[model samples]
Target: MKITSVIARQLLDTKTRPLVEVEIRTDTGHVGLGAAPTGSSVGVHEAFVLRDGNPAEYDGLSVHHAVASVTDHIAPALVGAELDLRVLDQKMIDLDGTSDKSKLGSNAIYSTSIALLRASAAAAGVPTYTYVADLMGLPPVSTVPVPSFNMINGGRYGDLTQPFNEFLVMPYKAESIEQAVEKSVKVFKVLDQLLTEKIGHKPQVASSYGYAAPSADPREVLQILAEAVDRAGCSDIMAFALDCASSEMYDKTAHTYELNGRRVSSAELIDYTRQLSEEFPLVFVEDLLDEDDWDGYTQAVAEIPKTIILGDDLIVTNRERLERAVELSAVDGFILKPNQVGTISEALDCYSYGQDRGLLAIPSGRSGGVIDDVVMDLSVGLGVPFQKNGAPRSGERIEKLNFLLRVADSVPHCSMADVSALVKA
Candidate 1:
């Protein structure tokens, strides 16, 4: 069947920012819905996210132009095209000749592309995840991944001015997503309690992810979270990770990165991260260096060879950038942010590239995600997957976890991911 029409509209995410939500109607009247997620800590190399610049409307972040572009340019062109992955995405790339998808906006492109995938699956009477797997030559997506819950956020996510961006925990030995969630929530609750006791105020919510606490010392925050792991009785299943997002805090003029009121050189940052890995059950350290710091990434990877040195902005989910990372011997893993690159095929290709090299493929959610749980499904389709979809908060973040839990409940014999393989003994 052909794609009959694509309807797009400007909408608000849970963060009250303007977002684009899309609905694709096929010739058979099958419909699919999708939303493009954005982030507070954006990578410079990422594809464009167009917005209106007028201050009066939507605080200069309006997506009305993008919505218009999708309706006026994108929809009419793809209306009669055959419904499939390659054709639609290729036509989109052809329409927007820029390498980084600036002309048409990555938000517009991703929302429409995602809508096509969902609508195609609905038209074929198959689950979206199953359809994605079949298209990618993957087996049925029966593996229920352990969810990496970002229980604490900082450096633009909330009022907390911590150096690192995200502090998350997941259950490593849980038998299923349900069990993983159960174990993680216990840690989150205990962490919340500890933060309240430490500061005489409850940890405030940070966006769609975890609780936010005021602490200058990253190790202290980890210590509190570790205690929560102990108090929850979830040490058997629980493990922690960090998203440094150091690019934001790096002072290029000063040639040092900001860290808890101190200037940290790249070497110093690497050493600090190395210490954290040695001291805690930190399986992943993402974006530890500035995006363009290949030497820094190589040093960190060399020093902490066991933990997953995931490249978020370092690679920006682009295969060419990933190749550059390989050439530099920078990272052993990469974070998959779908909007960063702009298509399902490209995202799958990024995962395949990592899989070919036996690198860690950690799919993650954006800072201001919408309600769709497609990321959770995409991660599960990768088999024994790991994902960062935010904490078990109400709204869009929990929607993703709920989707995983349903996947586990609906599918029989789904097992926990073997994350130990990616970590030091």
Candidate 2:
């Protein structure tokens, strides 16, 4: 497909935050729409999320610069270009020529890159995942990723009194994607009911992941998840995952984390994460330490060998950063956020790198997402061992989850990544 024109629009994501979406039109008359969802707890190494105009306006967050990059620069740069995914994406990166995509915002570049992927796949008349798999030189395996269900949210997502950001119900033993989602939903409901009975009312606040409850205790969350899984009659089938988002809590200057008013030292936090991993059915943990705390992650990952130590902020979806983490043995896997690196191809490279190092590659869509199903295809295309999706309630979250279900049905030999050994390890 020959690229024709590119356009950018400033839209609001599910969290009512400024987001940039790109629409790419090709000579084939196919239009591809792509979205980049911003997160409140972003990593320092992540590509600059730029804002323009007055600081007082819209919290000093605007997409005018990003929009201009797409329409004015990006659009002209590739108007008559052939949509070889790698070439097209690299053109944008080259145009910027910076490590963190400071010239054209990562949001602008990624949104456009994603839209190009979709448009090219559409012109080829194949499933988006299949096209991506071809680009990655991987066999088209219909592997349903292990369900890393983010069933509870804390920190930037909502109710930051709780130090832990995500309470995940991992359906490690589920036989299929359908069964996995079922187990997740049952546990979520059971937990909701338990919260209602223990507290005054059910957690009616719907977060990006799951029901947001006002609690700051990780032990309490662990206990509640166990009870909920047992009550749902799936104790053996489901385990827990924690996305601590510790960078959100870590005070860089003080070098101590504040948890519910207590100043927690790095050693204390690592000890606590290890404690929770051992005491609970925690199969996976992400960002348990500050992003820059290399020693802290090394210690935590060493102690929690059985649990999959995943890195989000620690790696920031960059292969160069992933190499540093590997050298330190700081993490076992990565939460691949494409926008963090400004290209799906780069994100795939990180995924491939993780695979060569015997690391888990988890393609993740941020919580405050959109209705676009690009993440759904990206997860399937990468053939990740796991894909982190949000809770069952939010309509925005359901769109991707439902699309996964449909993808599973479309592919003949769809198989889910079984985390049974990791959970029991």
Candidate 3:
């Protein structure tokens, strides 16, 4: 099968922000759809997203330029191309002729890349996950990732005054994806009730649908989360994770981080993180230091040896950055966001590189996500140890969870990825 046509348009994400959506049609009458998500706390080195600068349009956040890039540049090049995803992606990358995908927005290129993947999968008459696994040169496997459900929100994505961005609960002990999701839902309900009782009403939810915590203190927030897990009878199976997104709090001029209204140096911040891990069941801490602070990350990996020191903004799903991090021993794991690198093939390469070094790769969802559930298939297909979607609320978030549940039911003998060794005592 070969590509017959390509189309692009603008759509609103869950947060009502404009995003690019692409559609590809094959000669065999298979139609595939794709969309790129927007992130609220984007990394400095991630691929660029082009937007129209008209102040009157979506408050200057409209993606009309991206849409035009697809119709004017990408579609014309890809219309008669073969249905191979890598070749199509390379054509778009070469057409852009920029390191960061500035000429043709990452948003545009990524949507098109994903659409091609879906179309090819349809043409091959296979499930998306199976096709993706074949593309990765992996044999068939029925391993689903342990879900990292964000239970509380803070920092830029939340209305709370806390400095941390996300507080997550990972149900690693669950034998199946369905069981893991059930455990998360139970804990989420208990946490909601606890928060509602304490705040004297239904608590407000954050941008990612996690509850907006009432306190600014990270320790206090973790305590409440622990209490909820205990109440749900899931303390034995549940582990906690934090996404500090600390770069948002870092001041380049002073070379210090401001957390909970106090400016602290890198050493001080590491000590604070260590204290949290000691006090709570924190198995993972993401972006605990600034993106540029490789020395601080090395120190964190040394001091917090038990917990997984993961990187998001620090690596941006780029292979070169991941290579440097591996050389410096800066992180134990890395988060995978396909849009961050602008192409599924590149993201898969980065994941493969990290896996070759025995590093964990957690495919994650963005704050400004869409209804697309491609990440779910990617996580299961790659057999990654963990996947991070927000709390089991809202359509966009629930849609991904639903996909996992469906896969577990449909795939015979499928089992959840065992993550017991990664959990810290």
Candidate 4:
């Protein structure tokens, strides 16, 4: 089928959510819908074209806009040309047409590619995952694990720094959910104290409805989480993980420091990490070191217990960088975010690479916007044990949750994995 026209829309759900919706129509009248919601980067939509008379200027292009512009520009060229989307995506990346090497790009191209894949799958009368697995020579899967949720601490708190909204979550146990939230209040209060002591103002702290643990004082944090899990009514937490994006930041001498435990220092950062994982039921730690501290990251990974050390910012999504990370043994898990890399195929490649290394390849959505339900399909199709979307509240977070629920209901033998159990296992 040849392309007929492409229409796009910019929708804002609230101050925290902004999405670019694109509809591609074929000459054969087959219509496919795709979108990339950039919650943190709203300017990307403006950099793209409107259905009006004149298109917007290129100067308006953000990373997201650059992504969408590819669809606006390249979709027409491929029209009437019999081509496979996988190959087309490869060509786009090969030509660096939307690589965003300059760091000014969008995930719009990724959305466009997903739209084409959706259209191709519909035309073939197969599931999206089947098509991807068939093309990539990966096993097809029916079920995947869900993130316990980071937005809602048993519906007790919200993200205080960025947007203000409540999160919905399935608590650890009805009782622990309350306790965990109560602990969160204390933890954030402590964090606020630390921040106030350092930055002269309390850093607004957000609580995850279900998943509540910060990078500071991992042993104590895990205990608090375990208590929350028990209070929530789960048999056991199964596993504990740490989101350590600030790992490198704490050790930097130039940056301001605080008293995490007798004053946070470089040695203290690594020491605390090791202590927490060894003392508590820690399973994974993401971005343990700064993105650039490969040497420190390698050393830290080696010294820590055999927990899954994951990388998001550190590995970014470039194949070369990923290959380097693997060579250095920098991590044990990979967090796959399409926007981080900018294409589904690229993300899949990262997932596959991690899988080959016996590492968990997790595909994640974003903190904002609910585009289409392609990510849910991709995770199951690829057999990822865990996924990192957001809390089970609001449109951006609920889109993935609803997609999984619908899929589980329709597809027999498919259901949300006991996320906690899967993590520990």
Candidate 5:
């Protein structure tokens, strides 16, 4: 098949956030779909390098210069040149020791790679996951319980206007869906109380940006959450997971991170989580510190009870960094994001590695987009066993929830009827 054209679109997710979608068309009528950066000020233009009838091919290549080089210098060589899309991988060795995955920007490289992979898969008559598994010689994927996060119940932090958001704790399992709903309700109630105690008001849910405000102190916040869990209607809520995306505030650089106009560092933050874990237990804590502070992360995890210390931005979906974190004993879990790493295959590779090392895998969605269905599918197809999406509300959050609900209906016993199953593992 010959490469015929490459097209892209930048869709606004919110006033502050936008996501790039790209399509790679082939002469044989197969089109590969992927996402890159979005927005003019961001690296959107430099993300995709096209060689069709357009002169703006190099506009945004700075964000993904290496990938642009591949498309500009290498892809054309193979476009009308005729190579089997299946079984056709340009390894460093095969590229005459030239191409390297390390040379490309994280998002740019991932998007481009997956676009090529998907186009190839479509041309070869197989699902992208199946093609990937065949290439890796892996067994069929197993179905795992979907994980739902309860960030709606947390004290407010940061500027109320900022679009950024964070998930407070992950509850992995529940004996029944009703129990999960009840637990969620309590968490929100506790979150409200925590915010009222510290900031003097209920945290407002922003409609324009879609993030909760008051990014309050993690300590008091988790304590309130722990109390809510203790008082909630489910005896079986214990089996659910605990999310700690708030763990990263410790460093002096990002220390005193804003929450409801309050400044907090990692030291002041983690104790509440530790106390909660000791009292109620938890499944995982993601982004406990700025990515560079591996020592602090390791120390905190060791000190924090039996819960898993997960790395999201800290790990960044790179194998080398993840391996380094493992060697340093910095994490017990990984929050996988395809866009963060840039491709479906790379994310899966990281997930498999996490699984092999006995680390918990939590597939997460961007808090900023409606284009998250593919991520949900990839998480299930990869057998992550647990997924972390947003609250039961919000358009982006609801998008993921709807997909999981449909999946649950399709598979009877394997449904997300309980959140506790995710917690135990």
Candidate 6:
């Protein structure tokens, strides 16, 4: 099928931030829609999201420039092109000819790339996951990735003083995605009740749809989560994960981290992370160190051998960065965010590289995301071990989780991805 027309427009994300949305129409009457998700604590090396610097609109956060880039440049080049995802994505990359995709904007490019993928899949008369698996040269598998539900928020996403960005619960023991979501939702409700009773009112929801932490101490928040799990009768099936987003707390000049109202060196921070792992049933600690602190990450990975040391900002879904991480053995897994690298093909390449190096892949959603559910298909298609979309609340977050539920019902013999290997001994 050939691309017939392309349209681009500005849209507001979940956080009311401006983002670019692209729609591609094929000659076969298939229309694919996609939008770029922005991050609250973005990595320094991630792809640039173009924003109009005019302060009058959205406080200089408007994506009009991105929308224009898509309409003026991307559409003109791709309107009559083949509907092959790889070919179209490469055409966009070649046209932009920039390492970071600043010419046409990562937001514009990613939105178009994902739209092309969906349009091609629709033309192929197969589900998006099946099409993605075929493109990656993988056999069709009926594995739904374990969902990591972010239950507590801190750092940049919330008003809490805690340095950690997200505290998550993973119902890894659940036999199916439906069971896992049910268990996680129960825990979330229990936590909501507990927080309301403790805080004397309804708790605030953070940017990622997680409840704002009621305490500055990370331990206190974790304890509350543990209590919620116990109350929900999910203690045995649930494991924990943390996204420290440590770069947000790093003091570059002091060579330390401002953690919980105290300054600590890299070694001290690593020690603190290890202590937390020991105190809780933590399966992974993401971005536990600064993005550029390769030595600190290597040290953390070496010291915390049992728990998965996962990198998000550290790698930024870049293949070259992932290769460097493999050389340094800095982390056991990396978060895959498509917009971080500007294209689904690039994200898939990075994921394939990590898999070849024996690293885990966790497809994740950004806090300022739209209601797109392609990430869910990506996870199921790749047979990823886990996926992170915030708590099973809010429309955007629920859309992704609900996609997993639908996939579980549709795929024959589908089962939740095994996470026993990720369980800490």
**TM-score top scorer:** 3
- What tens-digit string does per-residue lDDT give for candidate 3 at 172-269? 88767887899899999999999998889998888778998778888889999999999999987888999999998899899998776678999998
Evaluation by TM-score, superior candidate among 1 and 4:
1
Q: Could you give me the TM-score of model 4 versus the true structure?
A: 0.73
Candidate 4: how large is its RMSD?
7.5
lDDT agreement with native, every candidate = 0.83, 0.82, 0.89, 0.53, 0.53, 0.89
* Per-residue lDDT over 171-193 for candidate 2, one digit per residue giving the tens place of the 0 to 100 score: 88888989888878888888888
Q: Ten residues in a row with the worst lDDT in model 3?
A: 154-163
lDDT at 365, model 4 = 59
Error of 2 at 138 (Å): 1.4
Q: Candidate 5's residue-wise lDDT over 1-425, tens digit each?
A: 77676544444443233344546678888878765432211112122322233336433333334445445544554455443433223331144232223343334344445566677768888766546556556655334444556553333334332112344444445544344444664665655666567657665664322225444444444455555556554334443344444433233554554433466555544665576566555566666565666776788777775667787767766677789889988887877766555455556677778778987767666654455445665665565666676565666666666555555555555444233444523
* C-alpha lDDT of residue 361 in model 4: 70
Identify the superior model by lDDT, candidate 1 or candidate 5.
1
For all predictions, the C-alpha RMSD in Å is 1.7, 2.1, 1.6, 7.5, 6.5, 1.6
Candidate 3: count of backbone clashes, pairs at least 3 residues apart or interchain: 0
Clashing pairs in 3: none
lDDT of 5: 0.53
Q: Please, what is the TM-score per model?
A: 0.96, 0.94, 0.97, 0.73, 0.70, 0.96
- Which pairs, if any, clash in model 1? 151-210
Model 6, 129-152: lDDT tens digits are: 899999899989778888899999
Model 1, CA-based lDDT: 0.83
Task: Tell me how far the alpha carbon of residue 152 in candidate 4 is from the true structure, in angstroms, after superposition.
Answer: 7.3
> Which candidate do you rate higher for TM-score, 4 or 6?
6
Residue-level lDDT of model 4, residues 1-425, one tens digit each, is: 66666655555423333455557667666666676644332212122222222225223422344434555555555566553676766755654443352222344555666777776766666877777767677755566454445432221123312111222122222122233334333433343344355445643344332333233333444455455444444423334555555532343555322334334544456666777666665556666655666676677777775466777667765566678888998777766666566666777777777777777776665555464657776876776666665644456555666565555566667644544542432
